[model samples]
Target: MITALLVLVAFGSSAQSGYDLWLNYRPMEASVRATQFKAMMSHVYFAGSSPQLQAAREELTRAAKGMLKTAIVNTPADQAQLIIGNIDQIAKRGDILKLSKAERPTGDGFIIRSVTNKGRKAVVVTGGTDLGVLYGVFAFLRHVQTNKDLTNLQITEHPKMMHRILDHWDNPNRSVERGYAGFSIWNWHKLPGYTDPRYTDYARANASVGINGSVLNNVNANVIMLTPAYLAKAKALADVFRPYGIKVYLSIKFSSPIELGKLSTADPLDPQVRKWWKDKVDEIYSVIPDFGGFLVKANSEGQPGPQSYGRTHADGANMLGEALAPHHGIVMWRAFVYDNNVPDDRAKQAYSEFKPLDGKFNDNVIVQVKNGAIDFQPREPFHPLFGAMAKTPLMLEVQLTQEYLGFSTHLVYEAPLFKECLDADTYAKGKGATVAKVLEGTYQPGKLTGMAGVANIGTDLNWCGHPFAQANWYSFGRLAWDPGASAEAIADDWLRMTFTNDKRFIDPIKDHMMRSRENTVNYMTPLGLHHIMSADGHYGPGPWTDKMPRADWTAVYYHKADSLGIGFDRTATGSNAVAQYFPEVRDHFADLSTCPDIYLLWFHHLSWNYKMRSGKTLWDELVDHYYKGAAAVQGMQKVWNGMRPYVDATRYNEVKQLMAVQYDEAIRWRNSCVLYFQTFSKKPIGDQYSKPEHDLQYYRSLHYYNVPGLGTN
Candidate 1:
């Protein structure tokens, strides 16, 4: 009895540690909503016994037990208060719920409704398939968690993108590139022999938000990951995730034919190379039948590709696409490439290289484009490729890890950043052609659409290093599932489910999350500034970093801060990079007066003394943004402190300490950039703002060593 009680205590403690993520399923507060949910979940009938159906049934039972404080009794369809199953199974009951052909759930879509038949009342959750049933179960739990009433429920939902995936940059050696939370969660050394329970929790959290795919390795691919030994380990994980409706994908090295197969050349046109990949793909399928396929990063960042043999990206992708065609798999060929030898705008290289190859790729090849033309900066215009590739499928890839937004130390909610790009009008097929529409394949129907987030998950106690950082992971999954979802609404649900239902706690915290990305942008890269972080780990400001192997890798190459002016000029007169966009977007960005102040410097070089939209000199306006950003961090500290009574001591204190560090770092960023840029402006920081704590030389001389997330490369 003592051991059992100890086990119970241990389980309770672990539940509050944030390892459960947003699916904590804490007990609901006593209220009308709680009573309603308890009654609705009292007697449940879940049809079918497949692994996917069983997983859904398990989740429903677990959630009901936790939130309603009662065991869910399995009952016949007529006696059950809640009926859960696929549409056909639910339809077996006569005249229970009638759905029109258009209203019926399709693909992975689901519908929830309140119905009455033969003097019996029940809430029926039905979907197109077993996977859809799993999603409906999660959505039903979310409604209860957010205190929503289910009496008059009429909800139908479907994922906006066909593939909502997480791209884990985790290495085989248990290190994660750009990961700030902790080491990689996959213990590859022991994987095939031992399956960890954490993997299930990870799948649960992902499924809760409708993420259906996971790529389990870094894009900087390794040949060993394709070996027979590792294949068995990956199969182990695939088996665990299959029940949760997640397909496992692996990132393959482009030269795997040569590196792993001992071939002389990995040319896509080489018959030997082509056969080698086909065999490897066959072996992979034999082990994991539901394998998602390969994600390739080639001809970029020194990774080998078909370019070595003078072949185009389509050649490389098609060769692999042909191998996986039988299994209906795809090749997510990354479009993050640039020639360091070429003296051109780095932002234009991807468009210049890929725009012409638009129609060349096979139907199974999807070119994964980053959200921005460049890497994931604090703020950037949507990638020009979004609407440009009408013939080829494109997937938007956003970073969930805080690589440039202060590396998990600062509270930066990324939903706004994602929405900013998704909502931007691409004007491809006219005014309504937003990036979201392009990603949803609205302009070009019957094409695969997807959104992949760089996974920020790790082995930390909180999963993410910062407690609030988990919100980024949550937000990415939510937005990927429905690009049209509001950031404010998502934050509201997250706050209530993760912390408390108290309005006082939810209201102010939601406001903080909504404004977080903008605040980080203000402090770190206000007014169109990009890529000025320190060279390696990207932890701190390094506006003076000009010594690098390549000019484009240097901060000065992008910012171009000189005595004359600041910012890179990408206009027609400059690199003509603006021409890459459709005329509507190009003309808007090209004209200085019309360009948004937020992106003023990204597309043009402006004088320090140029008049600003706010009627202040450019220099004065930049200074005010820096000060305002730092001050906002202090405001966040005060807001969080007031919530001590609402949150658990563990999570509340974790965020409290992290906020303090955030404020300190915000000051450092403000002072470092303000002082460094002042050298070019030759203007004094206005007396209204506090002077830099130290001189420019002091900030530049500061160096940090052994920073986390600098995995391998």
Candidate 2:
């Protein structure tokens, strides 16, 4: 009786850890544990010698141990019920070729099929290569976990995107830019001497979600990273992650010639500077053979670039590209460069700088552009550069960390944000030219085609600070692998794997997860409002702030609120930024009648009494959105409260506490935005809604500085 109680208690505890993520191979209850296949796995057959293949075997062993609660043997005897291998090993067994005829040639393509050869009850996980076999093994395990009968299964899978990567903006000092969870996961001080086990787990988590590469340092790079000492550290991590088919990348400081090489000038046009980078690239490749090349942030936000030396972005990118060309590595030069010095519209800077240089980039260089033109605000129209630079291979860069949307405090699922950009019709080549097509290299994937998520991972036991924030990491990987994947499907799968697979839990939580991003947008920056957060911490609302040095740096510059009304005007009459988009879509945004209502405030400023499509005036609509946002968060709390029985006490209570924080902050946002904007309208907030709890001055005076658990210090 005591043993029974202990067993129940142990089972109860595993349900708590979000560590299982999507590969919770935990055994089902006894009601279904006695099924035929559970007994059929009497022996196993796995054949391969590469590290990737060994990793595949280890994962299968771990899953078998967890689900079957027994040791699985190695040899392929008659009683062997499960077999996993590449096509070469599987075909050695007679007549299995009929089950899967042709072997795929892609490095990471897989085929799983049920076969009857020599009267054996066998399931084969075969792929074109070792990495493919690993993917095949993961796919098979997912099938098992989802309760699919493996008796007669045949499937083949390959990723649509060639390079799915995570760009970690982790500084050498153990800080992550826009990282909300915790300090950097890479313990640089201990590395090269001590290889943290967390590195392998990180690689495993990334590999499971189809992430193929990781840029290990901040794009605002440290020059010391190029030294041999750090190269050895990077090599140590590369060795650990290699087995999982993940390549390590570095963010190259563009001025490394000046910082490290003692060069006179770090000019892209100078032969000395060019030779310095070439030697550096050669040194990096020597340490790590499959080193996924450089991520450069230059000429933006005070970073040194070709512009500093009177050269173009292409000149700087191509110089590095030429150096890496021999090693088959590429350059991901960031297109987030906008003038911090100019008083012009920040939205128009990137477009103006790069559009003229379209088709000028070398084939080995990809321009990494953010989802929005501005820094990752809660909401903004898609970046004008998405379609404008048709000739240059543009890689999509998304912020997985919650930098602008309440950091780690709020429960915001970011699949909607990713989907918003991916699904937007760029109309670059007439209509139907989506950002996904641009990413997949289908529209233009030849030179470079990839999507990079600014990583949110940290040393937290749960990985991301909020347990639910894990969904953003998962969602980014899924979308990177296949840009057309359904956000709802990803959310449902995540809930089942992260928590219980119970319909009651999955249904409501999925609903909540799907609506969470929109809820955040409504509260923080709904209707195209952007960058109105508190100046330093970016934690709370500051819609009334306009005292910054540059006009575009002020909240007033973005929203343009006054006695007249609210929102920036970027039309031809204002900034002429609308002309940046291809005329097919540009015309729609230029004309108020055709522009989508959601973006109306983004591109135009109107009178406070201008009637909206919903029959409310502009002022009334703005207030209504703020009120509705607070109510939505309240609704989310109630929904989460009902899910107590579906998860364990620890995680259940942690999320509940965070949800409370989100609710309180959501109301604070409502109060601050409505009250600040009301000062401009000089209109009553109407007795139906609550008044500001505190005045604008009080809100502005409240400062949250250097908080440990927040982002981008």
lDDT of each: 0.89, 0.82
If scored against the real structure, what TM-score would every candidate get? 0.98, 0.95
At residue 713, candidate 2 shows an lDDT of 19
Residues 1-713 of candidate 2 have per-residue lDDT tens digits of 01123424654543455555566667665544335446545567776678888888777776776777766577653445667777777667656545435444356887887776457767777777888888888877777766666668878788877778999989888887778877898989998998877787788778878899999999888998999999999999999999998988899888899989999888999999999999999999999999989999999877899999999999999999999999989899998887767667888888888989999988889889999888888877789898777788888999988888888879999998899999999998778998888777876745678899998888665678889888999999889988899999888777776677689898888998888888888888887788888776667888877777566667877889889988778888888788888897789998878888778888998889988888999888888888888899999999989988887888889989999999999988888888788888998887788777888777767777785533331
Off by over 4 Å in 1: 1-12
| TM-score of model 1 (CA atoms) | 0.98
Steric overlap count per candidate: 0, 1
The prediction achieving the highest lDDT against the true structure is: 1
Per-model RMSD to reference: 2.0, 3.5
lDDT of 2: 0.82
